[model samples]
Every structure is written in C-alpha cells, then in structure tokens.
Target: MRFLVTGTAGFIGFHLAQRLLREGHQVVGIDNFSTYYDPQLKEDRNTILETYPAFSVERLSLENAPALNAAWKRHQPDVVVHLAAQAGVRYSIEHPQAYISSNIVGTFNVLEAARQHGVKHLLAASTSSAYGANLEMPFRETDKAVHPMTLYAATKSATELMAHSYAHLFGVPTTFFRFFTVYGPWGRPDMALFKFANAMLKDDPIEVYGEGRMSRDFTYVDDLVEAITRLVLVIPSERPPVEGDTLSPVAPFRLVNIGGGKPSPLMDYIEELEKALGKPAIKTFLPMQDGDVPNTTASPALLQRLTGYKPETPIGVGVPAFVDWFRQRYDL
Candidate 1:
C-alpha cells in the first residue's frame, strides 16, 4: 500500500513507518519538526526512516492545509494514518490553543484530504484522556466520552466527532483508535517513562502526581504499531443504520481501542524503570493537578474481535528494552 502518514518523526509514527517499510510498503511521511520537545530528536528519527528505500520524508505541519492538501493530492494514498498532534495533557492547560490548532484543526485538514482524495481507509489517533470524568475501568468504544477534563482531550474528542461527521456525510471509511499510555523506544520526552528515566539518571526528583496513586496501561511502542498495522486491513464496513457502540449508521466508520487491556500502578511502573536503569528515583509525590486522571485502562475486546490481537507486553520486559535503547542512544 502507498501510504501517507502524518507525524512520521514522532515516536509512534517513526515506529509505524519503520514496520511498514520493512514489510515492503511504500510510505510517504510528514512532520513539522516543532520544538515541542526537541526538533533534533525528530530529525534523528527521520534520519532512521531515510535509510529505507521505500520511505520518503517531508517536513511540514498539519496546520498548513494547502501544503497537506497538495501532498494528499499528489500521493493519492491508499490509506491515511493521522498521528500528528500537540500532545501533552499538562501543556494543554497553558497552551490550549496549540491543542485546538494541531489536534482539532489539524484533524480537520486530514479529514478533508481523506475525503478529497477518496482514500480507501482512514485511521486516526485518539486518546484515553477522552474518557475524562467517566471513572470507567476498561474504557470501551461504546462509553460516552462527552466530559473531557482537559482541552487536549476535548480537542481529540472533537476530532473523533469531526471524523464521524465526515464519514456520515461523505461515505469515508474512518477508524479512530483510543491509545493508552504509550511508552518504549523513541518515546516523547514529556511522557512519564522518559522523564522518570532522565530524572533518575541525573539524580533529580521525579514528580509523582496524585501522590503516586495513579495507574496506566502503558502500551509498548511495538505493540501499538502492530495494532495500527493490523487495522489497516479492517476498515469500517458500509453503514447499516444501527444505533449502538459508535458504529456509524450512515457511513463506514468505527472507534476502536488500541491499548494494553491491563492497568499498572504508577509506583509499579516507577519500580520497573528503577530496576531497568539501576537507579532509584528521588520521590516528590504531589496532589493531582488539574486535567490528570488517576488511571486509564482499555477494553481491547473490539480490537480483538476485529484484528485478532491485543497489546500484551508487560512493563517488566518493555521498560528494560527502552532503558537499554536510551542508554545506548544518549550514553546515559
């Protein structure tokens, strides 16, 4: 499949592109290379992708609608995987506009491109944060995701609705997957695992929000990429005019959960990282800040029903692998 994947420089995007390229798929990737963390990390990731003969990289942001539209028109891809977003729950509190621009508006651009290009199947990234204030264990696609606690989640939720609307109106087959806490090699710097490792390495106190009471289903990067790759073949069927589980009644669109179905406690995750790095972190437990959830777990039943797989990698094995990569890459 000739694919146009956004956020090719991102952690998940890089991994996904690599897997597809290794499998001999022609891939066209794009990224803005923003300083949200460090453009150098994105550049390094892109460099790795450049080694692939079937991979082509373009430097651009989703905000550039004209440029993105042209790329879509040029590639006329078989599939579209939209992963570019201004990602950070805490950062959203200060810079809500960034989330709106990148997640909401950026998603609008992708939907438009998918619709205009008449793409076969469209799979975009959503978040577990969309299940805000629900207090539901094992979040399902059928659960109501109306009350988003943070702007970041709100924008992502809005993108889901926007995609659904496009599917309903234009008959575009769209699959939106809610991702849990994703971590492993080439992870974002703001994520807990990365920060915890860096803090522990430098002998600094890693801030433990909610007094270390939170838990997360930290899906490994490879697991995530596999789930995504599998879904490329499972596009939503034609709308059948149904009523439950967000199965689009008007178009071929569905929302699926891609995550480790089991939840791991925050302290447990930290302990695993400590063992991986051979350094215990200085504790700084604090109250739960705004826009933070105590836990997030996914109900991968739908994913299994469709793709015959669920993310099952444990932190014990995954964290050490990531630590090894970090050590080798950064000389930690």
Candidate 2:
C-alpha cells in the first residue's frame, strides 16, 4: 500500500509511518517541522524514517494547499492519514488564530486533496476533547458533541463536520478517530506524562491539575498505531452498520474511538511515573484551567467492532517505557 501521512515528524505520525515502512509499504510523509515543541525532536524522528528505503518526506505545511495538492498529485497515494494540527488546550487560549489556521484550514486542504485525488480511504485524527461539557461518562462516538469548551476542540469538531460534508457530496470515504490521552515514548512535551517526567527529572514540582481528581483513558502509541493500521482496511460503506457503530446515515463516513475504555486516575498515572523514575515528584495541586475537562473516558466498542482490537496498554508498562526512553535520550 502507498500511504501519504501528514505530520510524519510528530509523535503519532512518526510511529505510524515507521510501522507502515516496516511492513514494506511505500510512505510519503509531509511535515512542516513547526517549532510547536522541539524541532530537534522532529528532525530526530524524520532522520530515523529517512533510513527506510520505502519512506520519503515533503517539508511542507497542510495549510499550504498548493504544495499539499502537488504532493498528492505526485504520489497518488492509495490512502491518506491527516494528523497535523496545532495541538494543546492551554496553548489555544493565547493563540487562537493558530488553531483556526492549522486545524481548520489545514484539515480543509487535506480533505480537498483527498477528494480531488480519488483516494481509496481517508483517515484523520480527532480528539476526545470534542466531548466537551457533555458530562457524559465513557463518551460514545454517536453522543452529542455540540458543546466544545476550547477553540482547539471546536476546530477538531469542525474538521469532523467538514469531512462528513465532503464524504457526502464527493463520495469520499472518511474515518475520523477520536483519541484518548495517548502517552508513550517520543510523546509530545505538552502532554501530562512528558511534563511530569521532565519536571521530576529536574527536581521541579509537577502541577497536578483539577485538584488531583481527573482521570483519562490513556492509550499507548503502539496500540493506537495497531488500531489505525487495522482500521485502514475497514473502509466505511453503505452496508449494514455494526452494533454501537457511528456510521453516518447519508454518507460513507464513520467515527471511531481508539481507546481501551479504561479510565485511570491522574494520581495513579503520576505514581506509575514515580515508580518508573525511581523518585517521588514534588506535587503542586491546582485548579483545572479553562478549556480543561475534569475527566475523559472513551467507549471503545465501535473500534473493537470494526477492527477486532482495542488499546489495552496499561500505564504501568507504558510509563516505564517512556521513562527509559527519556533517560537514554537526555542522558539523565
């Protein structure tokens, strides 16, 4: 299979592209290497991918439609995975325009490219944050996600709507997967696991938000990649819908939650990190910031029904793997 995956330099994209390359598939990666976190880390990931003969990359942003279309025309990929976006809830509070441009305009371009190129299947990344203010435990894909708390969540939800419209009008098959709190090696710096590990290593206090009462369905990167890999073959159609499926009634589009349906407490996650790092973290309990949800848990019924798999990596194994990678990468 030939795959064109955006944000190949990002954490999940890197892992997904690497998995595809290992399976002997040709992958054309697209990344602008934005300094959202550390460009050096992005470069390191790209450098590793460059060694694979079946992998190639284009240095461009998804907001650039001309360049993106050019890449699509050049590669003529069989599948498209859109993952690039301006991520981070707290960051969106200060820089709202960035979210609009990257998440909105960027995803718009990807949808256009996929529509024009007649790709077989299109897979894009959404977030669990879309289930904002619903107060619904174990969010399902069919639940009402009308109230988004932040600009970031709003943009992601908008992406889902736009993709649905395209799938309806243009006959493009699309699958939008809402991710839980994903954590693992090569994770984003803005994520909780990375922040806690970094702060603990430096002997700094880790900020415990929501007054230490938050919980999340933390999915490991490898598990996410596996689910996505299997889902690439489960393209949506007008056939009968599976039980608990979120398939659109009018279009060949679907929404699936890629999680384990297991919500772990925030304090328990920190404890796992402490155990992995062999040190206790100095904790600073604080109120939950605006646009922050107290808890999020995904119902993985649809994902399992479609892919026959679920994200099952527990924190005990995942946290230690990340800690080991952090130590070797930074020599701490």
Candidate 3:
C-alpha cells in the first residue's frame, strides 16, 4: 500500500515511515524541517530514509494548503497519517500563534486533502494532554477532554472534533489516537528524556519540575509505532463491534489511547536515566510550571481490545536504549 505520512522527519513520523518501508510499502513523506528543534536532526533522519528505494519526500509545511493539495494530487496515497504539528506544551505558551497555524490551520488542510483524495484510512495524532485537568486515572477514550490546560492540548482537542465532523460529513474512516508521554531513540530534544540524558552526560544540573511529583505514562517509541501500524488495518465502522468501543454512531470515527498502561514518577524516570548513563545528575527540584498537568496515565484496554497488542516496554529498558542512542549519535 502507498502511504502519505506528514512530519516524516519527526520523531514518531520518521520511525513510522521507516517501518512501513521495511514492510515493502511505498511511502511519500512531507516535512517542512521547522526550526521548532534543530533542523539538522530532521535532516539527519531524512538522510537515512532517503536511502530506501520506496521512500520519497516533499519539503513543505502543512499550513501551505496549495502545496499540500498538490502533493495529495500527485501521490493519491492509499492511507494518510497526519502527524505534523507544533508540538511541546510549554513552547505553546510562549508562541500561541505557532499552535494556531500549525495545529489548527495545518490540520484543517490535512483533513481537506484526505477528504478530497479519498484515502482509505486517516489516522491523526492527538495527545494524553487532551485529557487536560481530568483527575481520572487510566483515562479512557470516552472520557470528556474538555478542559485543556495548555494551548497545545486545546489545539489537539480541536483537531479531534474537526476530524469527527469531516468523517461524519464525508463518510471518511478516521482514528484519532491520543499518545501518552512517548520517548525513545531519535526523540525530541525538548522531551525530558533527551534533555536529562544530555545534561547528565555533560555533568550539568537537570531541572526537576513539580518537585519530582509529576507522573506520565511514558510510552516507548517502538511500541507506539507498532500500535499505529496495527491500527492501520483495524479501521473503525459506524456499527459498534464490542462493548465500550468508541466507534462513533454518527461516523466511522474513534479515539484510542496508546501507551504502556503504566505511569512513572518524574523522579523515578530521572533515576532510571542516571542508571543508564552510569552517572549522577545534579538535581534542582522546582515547582510545576503553568500549562502543565500533574499526571497522565492511559488505559490501554481499548488499544489492546482492537489490536491485541499493548505497549510493554518499561522505563528501565527504554531509557537505557535512548541513552545508548544518544551516546552514539553525539559521540558522548
């Protein structure tokens, strides 16, 4: 099958595209190489993907509707996985326009392209942050995600609603999966794992937010990608298949939470990193910043029910793997 994957140079997108190519699927990737992080990292990822015979890429932002439309016309992809967005909750606080343009406007273009191009399945990325301020443990797909703590989560929540409208109106099959704190090799620098690993390697003090009280369902990158690949084939339908199935009665749309089903404390995660690096980090505990939730956990029951798969990697295994990659990548 031919797949059009946005943000192909990004952390999750790159891994997903590479996996698809390994399975003998044709992949058309698009990435603007935004300066959100270092563009060199994105370029490096694209370099490896370029070596694949079945992989091709376009350099453009999702906000460019005309360009995105043209690419859709050219590729006519069988599946559209929209993953591009201005990520980072704290970053969104400083630059709200970035979130509006990239998340809202960019996603709108993707939805229109998918609708017009007649793609079979459209899987877009959402976040556990969407469960903003909800005190519920093991957040379910059916839980109300009304109170988004940050502009970033609000934009993502908006995308989910927008996707539902398009799917209902155009009879498009769509899956909006909310991801918990995902981390692994080739991860984003802004993420805690990356920052902590780098700081520890340099013997610098790592900032501990929420006084080491915050918790997250840290999903492994490979596990998240595997769940997505499986969901590619498990398209939703209007008719419900099982109990508590999130299949929309009005449209072929659903929401699934992808994570390890385990929440780890921030301090514990840092300790795991320290173990991986075989070094101690200068710890500086601080208060939680604005637009930040105290904890995020996912109930993988829905994902497992649909795909018979669940994210099983623990921090002990995943953190060390990332440290190893970090050392090799930076020659630390």
Measured against the true structure, the TM-scores of the candidates, in listed sequence, are 0.97, 0.99, 0.99
RMSD of each: 1.7, 0.8, 0.9
Q: Runs in model 2 with CA error above 4 Å?
A: none
**Residues forming the 10-long window of minimal summed lDDT in candidate 2:** 237-246
For all candidates in order, the CA lDDT equals 0.89, 0.93, 0.93
Clashing pairs in 1: none
Q: Give the residue spans of candidate 1 off by over 4 A.
A: 238-245
For every model shown, the clashing-pair count is 0, 0, 0
Model 3 shows how many backbone clashes? 0
Model 1 lDDT, residue 159, Cα: 95
- Taking the tens digit of each residue's C-alpha lDDT, what string does model 1 give over 1-332? 99989999999999999999999999999899999998899999999999998999778889899999888887778988989899999999999889888998888988988878799899999999999988868888898889999999999999999998999899899999999989999998888888888889999999999999999988999999999999898878743433335677677889989986899999999999999888789999999999998889898888887777999999999999999998998986
The candidate, 2 or 3, that scores higher on lDDT is 2
